[model samples]
Target: MTRPLLSLTNVTVAAGRAATAKPVLDGVSLSLAPREIVGVVGASGSGKTVLSKAVVNWLEPPLTMRSGEVLFEGRDIYALRGADMRILRQRISYVGANPMGALDPTLPVGAQIVEKMRAVVPGTSRRTAERRIIELLDAVRIPSARNRFHDYPAQFSGGMMQRALIVDALVTNPVLLVADNVTQPLDVTVAAQVIRLMKELTTTFDTAVLFVSSSLPVAREACSRILVMDEGRIVEEQSTDDLVERPVYPYTRELIRQTPKIWGETVSTSRHDDQREVVLSLRDASQSYKVRKKTGFGGVNLVRAVRNVAFDIRRGDSFAIVGESGCGKSTLMRLLCRLELPSSGQILCAGRDIATLKGRSLLEFRGKLQMVLQDPFGSLPPRTAVGKMLEGPLRTHGWRVEARIRERVLKVMGEVGLPTELYEQLPLGLSAGQRQRINVARALVLEPEILIMDETLSALDQAEQFKLLDLFEKLQKEYDLTYIFISHDLAMVRKACNRVAVMYLGEVFELADNERLFFDPGHPYTKALLSAMPTLEPRRYRPEECLLEGEPPSPLDIPAGCSFRSRCPQAVDKCSRLQPSLTVRERQDFAACHLVLPPTASGGIGGVGTTVP
Candidate 1:
């Protein structure tokens, strides 16, 4: 048998001083063979991240390796010093969760990677390093690798930034790679692409990978062997299939249970009712901005963030808008909330154009349509108490009685699952789920008719998400609230949303009921998204046939014909010269594709044929 490439023998990691320290990783032992992929999965505070950091000796400050040994190629890495330590670091690479903060913002992204390369391998020339970095960038499927070399970190999309970080990790040809929740911040399609790239690179580079994530499905997609962690202990370890199918521990089974299913048995009931009133409507709405060029010279490019988008959200409907990063989901959310008026066309709220509202009318509109932003902690004022934070919205709308305000605040807090005891406490050190509940309570305090949730559940673990979703369902039924969910999580959408709209490059590619969109999608883009969704069930759409290549074109330089044609697998000659308009393909189901023939034109609604179960 081959010797393990990396080994941790009874490792114990702790945080804080020796007397009062708490063990974050308790007696964890694991081994990794060359070219093997291992996954460590658990909930938020279960020590998954701590284990990854311990493996790479990246732990600092209060985090200390209290005992045991970490052996790389049969040698203890902790004892290495000076030049030996440098060599060990060169043999291992660590990629973190947040990509935007990974690189230096003041320097070019590629240049920073090249600098690291030169440092690790001394005597390397700049020209030689640049050529290799660009090659790795191309190998990672970064579009226009040569041109993007000069671009700063801010210019790259979230997916592109992540791929760039991978390039940085793999540039040195390390023997081991530590990836800590690297795909949590990406869209489903982009995350799938990154997972595939990592698998390919593991074979290509003969490197072992330690994939740590809070999401089991994502880890199962990338790793061969799995370890389940809970409360700083490895509760179970087994092959990926066995662990998922036959979990031995109760914690492991609960983790699997909490993972949202895409195509499994669902409890969602059809809630669409045509007689329902139209709470919000968008009529040919479009938004644009002038952005500066990459060159220092004075020049600007027109970025059409949203273009002629049309949709009607009915009362008490859970509507969803989904797409990959840079596909204009945020821009659409801003328009719907009236934070930014559309450049052209109208956004109607209860048959009244929101653009024409002013003064009291605008304030009333704001109260009627409240928004719950994505970042739970960042959205809250850190220093303010939860009670005061909730009261601000009430006071802004002319509530003078403090007694009544306190009564209302406590009532809303209880409705959102926040304990009344937390009213006097700051948001500091609260769990992500609790912080998010505060955000929800703040929105609910306004007694809004519509609530727009922009990736509200993306930052949470699966268990928290599952609980919060249940809470949302109860609240919606009790309050008769209409929810607008802007997210890339298809599983959550599958469970919660009644109507769905698939967006791509500032255009809605398909609009249909959730059942039709998942079972019989009408457009190629929507199919690709469904295919890329991570799930444990047998996939209806095979990813090999439906997954897209590279990334979508920049909004500033969108393709002339179909905005999505550049990445569409079934694009034909007609798609290059004429753009398809959103038209009905079936009963009330709309698709923007020339290939999709309406039911009247064909024997049935046919485009890209339906998936086989």
Candidate 2:
């Protein structure tokens, strides 16, 4: 029998004060073989992250390992020092959940990668180092890798930053790689691309991987063996197929059930009719930005953020824009909220163009539409008390009566399941879920009819996300509100939304009812997105099923013809020469694809008889 490449023997970690400290990882043990991929999964605060850090001997202060041995290649890492320890670290790499924070913001992202690579491999020539950096960048599916190499971290989207981090980790071909929730912040399509890259790297380099994640489905997709942790203990360990098919642990079974199912599930039967009045409409709306190039020295580039987006948002309906990062979902939300005027087209609110509204009228229009940002803590002021935070919006909107404003704030706080006693406390003291609830309450305090949520649920745990979603449904009914959700989770979109629009490279590729879009997608990109949804089924879904080859093209220089042709597996000569117009195949359902046959030809989803608003 061969010895394992790495092993943790009876590890224990504790936090808080010395006398009253508590253990976060209690006597956890695991092993990994060379060329093997192992998954450590648990909810937040379950000690999964602690265990990963401890293995590399990187535990920070307040997290002391009491008694344990982290053996790599039969040598205890804690007992090594000086050059020995440095050599060991060079053979191992770590990538955390927050990709942008892991990078140096002041430097160009590619320069940082080159610096790290040269530091790991001493005396490497600059030419060799630069060549390797671009190779790794392209390997991780970053579009226009050469141009993006000179851009800062802020210039890249969340998903693009994650890909860059993955490239950094693999640039050295380390013996062991530790990835902690690297895909949690990315969209489904981007997550799938990252997972496929990891699979290929592990095989090609014979590298052992430790994948730590809070999502069981995501872990199952990327790992062969999995260890389940709960409240500082390893509760279960089994092969991926066995765990999914016959999970013996109660906690594992619960996690499997909580995983969202994208296919073969019953549709939402919420009593929202399609004949409601139109609350908002976009007529050939587009948005563009002027960006400065890196090498050209004051040269500028025009980037199209949203292009010719047209849709009708019905009153009392849940509408969603589903797409990967940098797909213009956020840009479209900004247009609807009047944060940016459309460059060429019209954004109509209540049958009037919002661009034409002046000072007082624009303020009034903003009062009717509010937005809930992606980061709850970032969006709210940390120094201000929750009560003041919620009240500020009311006061800004002209609720002069102090007593009435306080009463309304408390009411909305209760409506969002936030305890009234915590209103006087600062936001820094509250948990993530509590802060998110406060974000919702602030938006609700203004009594807005249209609420836009931009990736609001992407940062939460499974239980927290489910709780917030339930609250959204309840508030939507009580206030008769219309929701405009911008997200990348197709599973969540299927359950929470009634109508769906699939956007790709700043254009709507397909628009249809939720059931129709999920069951029988029309566009190739939409189909690829649906197929990439993570699941815990016994049989794994291979990446080849959907056949998306590369990342999306850059918005600065979108392809002349179909923007998706570069990645679409079904592309042809005609697809690259002509951009397809939005053709209606069914009532209120449209698709912009040259290859998507008409409904009559393929027995596709029949025309919806009811009108849209």
Candidate 3:
């Protein structure tokens, strides 16, 4: 019976001139009550972003509002002008996907937010603004809010920057907030915390929210009601529980089906074989960098990126390394492929120390171990044709004849599911999935035994990811290839990887087969990550019990003892005095936690945490 805080009726948005406009949002209608959270779910190019931008009238040129009425407090927002429009705009805030680009690089993040606050609120003293900003920052769970306020945007991590952006959006105490894919770039734990924070803040501030995301599970976590968008139209709308349990539209059903499951039936069969030859191995390998301090002093800080990492990849194994951002997954990937020599220890490729190799030996190592980098578009050369791009690796490795090179390039392209017709086409207008396939083809052209996929599928949508995963499975079987996946996508890992290594603060917390790690993890951090993962199935680990608080300690100043103990909930007295080494918890499972008792003990397995039905 309460009046809706915002309403859109028969809203239609289109691109280009009137004579040749194409619809982006077709007859979309929705209403948000006070303090209510509504979600819009769809795949890429589904017009979800357009609808969010339309709510705040932030759409630019080429995006024309064809027909619609957007009402704020029962008043037509489009009819308002000048001061009225400015005031209305101030009452609605939008937070986008990229928090790093939102704040000015030249100014302290807090100063930029305060500047906006004064501009909109008017007559607010600097001291009062600072107090309010810091309060909101703390409310969003940024540790040492006062100290971090003076830190530059570059100083804050991805999760911290996102929380700061939320603080900026809420500083005005708007009646409505439009969050567009804000959590897409964050880690699972960080995303869960942000979602929980938004729920609490919506109640505290009595503000409605329009949560837009490509991920259905993420939307389900934060919203009461969901709207499924497809090709600029609202295909279906229902309560979150009812919609997820029984969807009405085909697209919605497909979206639900495409969402990777974590606790469901195993998708990838066991491919682990200890008898197989070890393709790659690491022995106490470590890496670090000396970064200069921001104070213009001559002193520098040592960033311990990777420390004492030990792992082995057998032929035909699908191994994964998963952790939050800055957890040394990337550094380990570099070490595995010999991009950088380890500061200490050894990285052995086929029983030969990679760091000791030079000239022809190094070239041979490069040929044997190829890498497919992240950022599909950025990794590819825009001007180069797809065929030529794929051929470069083959040419570098000595495929002399042009005819033979073209033949090999086309064959690799087919293996990655790229059409032959695209061989001569430039990568400029190609889709992200297509560009990534080219990268995969480029790596595969080398006929390498080991392939390191560094967040290779993160840029893709659910459907594209599924297709690529299937392709990888086929290639693995045919080529006898070994895969090293470095990613934050636990769902994909759950479905695709055979073995997993959980890392935290540059240390491997747990390593085990996929089933054991997912079903019965020994380390608390692994449990926390599983709990924080967004999935449709009922959670195995309760978030309230397992979710970590705040962020990991800075790599530059890692704590003594256990690096994870600072945020760990079950830390004991001994955890502060001594660090636990990787102890065998089961036949092949290893965990570095003080609380986990060895299987020989009466406590069968993982007595540290409880699970939910």
Candidate 4:
């Protein structure tokens, strides 16, 4: 029995003085058997995340686990002594939902990994620790483990960095590995890839995994047993298959219905394509970040984020690009809108190459292609009125200062569901969802033909995601606008995208219809990515799910082969030796991995040292 790897007996987390701050967790109890994978699901602020943090012996300050006992291998963890507890803590790791919080910019990623590894083994020399580090990196599929081991956090992309942090968490080989909202943000394919990797890692190590997320479908796919929490209380618990088949709780059923799947009405939209032409087109589009040292290690650090990645956005079309955090999804969005110019690529917008435009031309182009960034808070200025925020873009584009701008602001704000009184209120004064409304209103002000949405819905509530998604579709159809939807949430991508492109390590690994990409994936990397999507679809089980543990290669040290070959389940000997170029796989579907197609007749990927000329 192994005495059940871990168990929470009558766990309750309270925030205020004993009877003051309400309880965040209410008598929640769960147990994990050795090597068993369990998932906890709930809405945001449902206390699922709080419960894991409590169990990992990290209640931090002011917050206490109240009366619950956290048992690790039959021993009470909350009652453990300082040094003794640290030892136990070293054996149990928590990979948080927020990756940015875990990484320290001052240190290189490799050193960070090794540093965690060194903690578990006391006199282990740096060299020995480094060796273990290599093995660990190898396990995560981070190519050139030795070279990147010393690279700082800034060197990695969002998903790669997340993977690195996960590797660091697993460095201790803990009996209990708790993952919070691990794959909710990834697109179906990329999310699927990450999910598969996590499952594989947990399986290979025979570690008990506790997955916490707000997605019921995701939890259903990743865990055999599922627990549903609402407002900090466990309302339902059952086997994954049983729950999906017969959910006893109404809220749980509603959650499953809303969870985005490969092809589902995750969000209902009335947008029809007959309303308009191609709004924005990228012909051989590429974007390079002249790195020039991310943290002062200068000389030559330019990153060609999106190299020769091509796609189009038709009028009223939602073209979603899905990838792990750092897979150039945002870069592609920026490049398409000319927010960042391509080193050598043509972005034809309204039949003009906006890449070479400058001065007034560039300024005017900005009005036509507005971007709604991922962080809504980041979108607004401090003490700036939401009304003024909307008017600035209008004013910048030469909108009159009179009643016209005010009228436009008030109207768009209303469309976003904000009150007219909010016109003068600062963005800081509003709630999270309201601030996002401001973001949407501001972007729609210019009524740009092309809207580059970079993770715009990531911070909003599910209800909010649905609202904004509806607003986007309505506007798209009404104004005949185009959208380049960038997100990690695959379900959203599936629901939103007419066409989808999957990016990996700054390259488009696969591009196709959303259904084709998810259902009949041709690229091995694409298949792995789809498999990695944490799905509640119990019927679509694959053994490869257990092999997706490693992170992607560093963009700086990208492998010469297919960018995804390192993690591709179908990777062959030819993968590492040659690069894979994007080509038509089936119908409109395109992929860059050799696992899907053979190397080109030229004997290698077209260009050398660069992705596409």
Candidate 5:
């Protein structure tokens, strides 16, 4: 048999300094051949990242590699000298999960990439290095590469920063690439493009990729072989097809079953929609920000973050705003909650114009609408005890009796599945899942009618996400609450939400019930987003054709007509001339696209490149 390009033989990683230290990775063995793609998948604390770090001797202090060898080209990497190891690492690149934190905040994003290339390839001319950097940036689908080359990491979105890190890893043209949950922060469309680029690299440069992610669907779509890790051990290893189709281990089977499929059995929402009371309504709602130019003369530009968008959330509706980053989902959320008054149009909350609400009315509105943010760690007060944090909100909102506040806090904590003992403990002492539950508990303390979950599940692992989803469903039914879930996870959205509004370039491109939206997307952008969603079936997956090309156009200077025309595959002359308005179709669907045929016409549902009129 041909020698494996990289191999880990009986690798064991233990925490702490003593012999009795707990093992995080227990005798985990794996191999990757040249030009091959292998995936390591597990729940959050399953030693997947630990084993990846061990492969390259990147384990930090207190996490020691005990016994076993990591062989690269038949040589033990652990046995190599410091200088030799450094040289070996040049041919083996690693891009970590926290791209923003991974990069130096002091330097420009472009400078960091250039510096890596210079450090790896000695004596390369500055002029040659710069040209190569631009090429790399362009290759990674960063729009207007030269113009944004000097931009800082803070300026880029989470997805943009991830692409920059991927470019940094590939700039050296390494023989082995180690990507650890690199696509976790990205939306499905952008993540698809990045995965497709990785696949192309394996073919173009004959690079072996060791991809580690908690998302099994992403792994199944990208990897040829997969290794399932449980508590400190590799439970099963098999071809991606076998692992997904016929897994021996229960853990592996559970993972396959838990992975959110984009298009599955349609969840019935007819029962929920029967009693329709307009809880929130957006009538020609629009939001615009006056952005000052970074360079040149000081002139203000009206960057329309959200265009003339109109939607309604009926009572107890799980309405979702699905879009990629910078697509105005959050901005619209702000508008809906009265955080930002819409520059144009009316936002009616329970038949009251929220934009005009003030003083006592605004305060009451705030109590009615509560928001749960994405980052559980950052959202919670680290120094504040869970009991104090949860009770303080009720006290501030005029719940005077101390006994009543304590009783309310404890009740909500139990509702969110958090242990009652954790009430007195600081948020820092809690696990990530526990912290998120605390966040949920904090929101529920007010007994809000409308709950806005802004990417709350994006930061969690699959298992943790499932738990939260279950809690969300349970809470929604019990409280008779309406949800406005702002997320990019299509599968999660499909499962949790009854209705979806596909946002793009600050416009509501498509709005439909979950079943029709997923199975038959009318708008091209909606179709692209659905197609980019990673699936367990490898043969059924097609990332290249569906992945959106290049980064979305800047909202600061959005194109006149169809804002999505530049990246859209089905763009025609008419699409460039005029923007399409959302037209209500049969089956209670709405789509803002010139290409989709009318609902009344024959062969209209899947007919692309056809005029509606």
Candidate 6:
């Protein structure tokens, strides 16, 4: 009825040149209205990003529009040229697939945000923009807006930088926001906070969002309408609730059927639950990292990445550390892997003080504890082939025989469900998921007793993610391995971990069984995290169901009582002054909060044991 804010009819995009470039999108069509959010989702390489780019006229040549019509405010933007193209480009805001790479790394967060605002406003003074800059930063829940405004992109954490980028986009005041795979490698709780902020800002400013993700459940929960893509076409279009509950397309059905749920976790027998074969214990271990110079004094600049974090990962048990992004999850994993030495407290591995490792002992420790990083791009050598990548570590550990090394490489590849043909292919040729599998296979080749995965499955689609998680679980049992599963995906945490530890400002807030962590949280931050998990039930969420406001405290200047107190809904004045230690009471669990546990509480989990190395 009302002219659509944007629309695309019969759009088609190609994948490659010599590679047949089969039309990834086929005769797809859709329309959007003012102040509405549309989610685009499908398997990897299904042209979700391509379609979004085409709508904004950002599509490059070769993989041309081919045949299609994209209308912006009743005007075919595809037909616009010169001044018209420039005007349309300015009107549309696009946050790309990689948030980490989107901003100007050389620029300060404040400068980048203001630059966009100035470009459009013309003659708007920097002083006039600076006031709005503080508002924008605070609007996105960034802490220390005035003081940290001068910080460069590298100085901010991954999630903080993402908020900065979103603030940059908002400065343009565009009618439509297209976010492409922006939530990659971050946990669901943090992802929800971003989504909530986007939604609120969209409504306040009368903006529409084209939210693109590989996670169907996230789309289903966050979007009112959804575009289910395949190859390069809109395979199905329906209300988010209707499509998720009653999918008619085979591809959409497969997506729903294959997607791993991230809420209301099921019980699992993971490495952290093993009481009989405990391997590593953290006795009030804490790790603090200094922010890059220029933030302030060294003592003032320190971020307690993991504080008094305690948990036990038994042999063949999986203990998950769950929280939002920038919650110091990676630091905790590094502590277990011995990549980072603790700032205070100690860790005992198999009844020995691992803090004393050096020389050959450190090398031996490294060989004994392997890690899978969140980014395959960062982990893998771009020039190396998959097989050689796997073999290098084996040879470095003194494994002999050239053929045997190759043989061992192939075996691990197959174990991780990689094909033999992929062995000779360079890391450059593989997909994101394949590169991750190689990362996993490389770690597996070491035959380490403890495997620490730092949100490894967060980047992948449900199908790819489940396959790797299942494989890791099986291999843990087969090899008598231990796992420190660090993630904020509550569903995966529940399904993958036997016990759970919650972290904030470099300290373990609460440690318990996975069941209690999800269904019966004790710590206030833990409750907020569990409440923030996106649901696939296709029902409307109450206002209370939305995530907490305010950014996490600067790891540099953590509050005395509770690091999470700034964001905790149940925070009290006492919560502000007295730092809670990891205290065990009754036979329940270890919690860092002042709240007393019920003697006969039935909802949360028990037998959680203690925080270990």
Per-residue C-alpha lDDT of model 3 across residues 1-613, encoded as one tens digit per residue:
9999999999999897585688999899999998999999887788988999999988898898889899998988888888988788678999998888898999999999999899888899899999999999999999999999999999898889999999999888998999999888788999998899889877899888999988899999999999999999999999999999999999999999889888777666465457989888899999999998877779898999999999888888889999998899988988887878999989888899998999989999999888898788799989988888888887888789999999988888888888999989999878888889999999999899999999898777787888999999999989989899998889989989999999998899999999889998988899999999999999999998999989899998988888898888788887888889987776677899887766655355553332211
Positional deviation of 265 in candidate 1, in angstroms?
A: 1.4
State which candidate has the highest lDDT: 1
Residue-pair clash count for candidate 5: 0
True lDDT of residue 469, candidate 6: 78
Tens-place lDDT digits, model 2, residues 1-613? 7799999989988885385678889999999999889999987778988998998899899888887889999999999998888788777889899987888899999999899888877888878988988988887778889988988999898878988987788777888999999998889988988888778878777789999998888898899999999999999999998998899999899887777766656867343366889999999999999988756688999999999999999998889999988899988888888878889899899999998999889888988998888886688888889999999988887889989999999999999999999778888757678888999998999889999999888877776787888899999999999999899877779779989989999999998888777766778788888778887643223457674766688898898899999888778888899998776767777889887655666555554222111
Return the clash pairs for model 1, or none.
none
Which scores greater on lDDT, model 4 or model 6? 6
State which candidate has the highest TM-score. Answer: 1
lDDT of 3: 0.89
Candidate RMSDs in order: 2.2, 3.2, 2.8, 6.0, 2.7, 3.8
**Ranking of predictions according to lDDT:** 1, 3, 2, 5, 6, 4
User: Model 6, residue 555: what's the lDDT?
Assistant: 72
The Cα error of candidate 4 at residue 357, in Å, is 3.6
In model 2, the Cα lDDT at residue 75 comes to: 95
Clashing pairs in 5: none
lDDT of 4 by residue, 1-613 (tens): 3577888888888885568778989998888988788989876678877898887878766677778788888889877897878689677888876666577889787777777677765777888877876787777766566777877776665566667777888777787888988765455554555666678866787777899876676676678899989988889999988998899999888886765555333344323344457667777776666556546555776565776777666776788887766778777776776667777768787788886688899888888888888776666798877777788888888877689888888888777688898777766656667777777788888877778888888765565676677787778777777788888776567667777888877777777776666666656655555555555554343645523555666566777766676666556788888887876654456767554542343244432111121
TM, every model: 0.96, 0.94, 0.94, 0.81, 0.94, 0.91
- Model 5 has an lDDT value of 0.85
Tens digit of per-residue lDDT, candidate 5, span 1-613: 8899999889888887689998999998889999999999999889988888887779998898887889999999888986787678678999898877988888998888888888888787778877887887887778888977898998787788888887888777789999999888889888887888789889777788999999998997789999999998999999998888889999988887887765555565523354589889999999999977776798888888999999888988999999998899999989987878899999998899997788889889999999999888899888888899898778778899988888889899889998899878887756678888988888889999999999999888999998899899999989999999999998898788889999998899998888777766778788888888877643233445555877788888888788899988778998888988886665557889887755555455643223444
Q: Write the per-residue lDDT of candidate 1 for residues 351-431, one digit (tens) a residue.
A: 999999999999999999988887877899999999999999999999999999999999999998899989899999898
> Model 6, residue 284: displacement in angstroms?
2.2
Question: Looking at candidate 3, what is the lDDT of residue 393?
Answer: 83
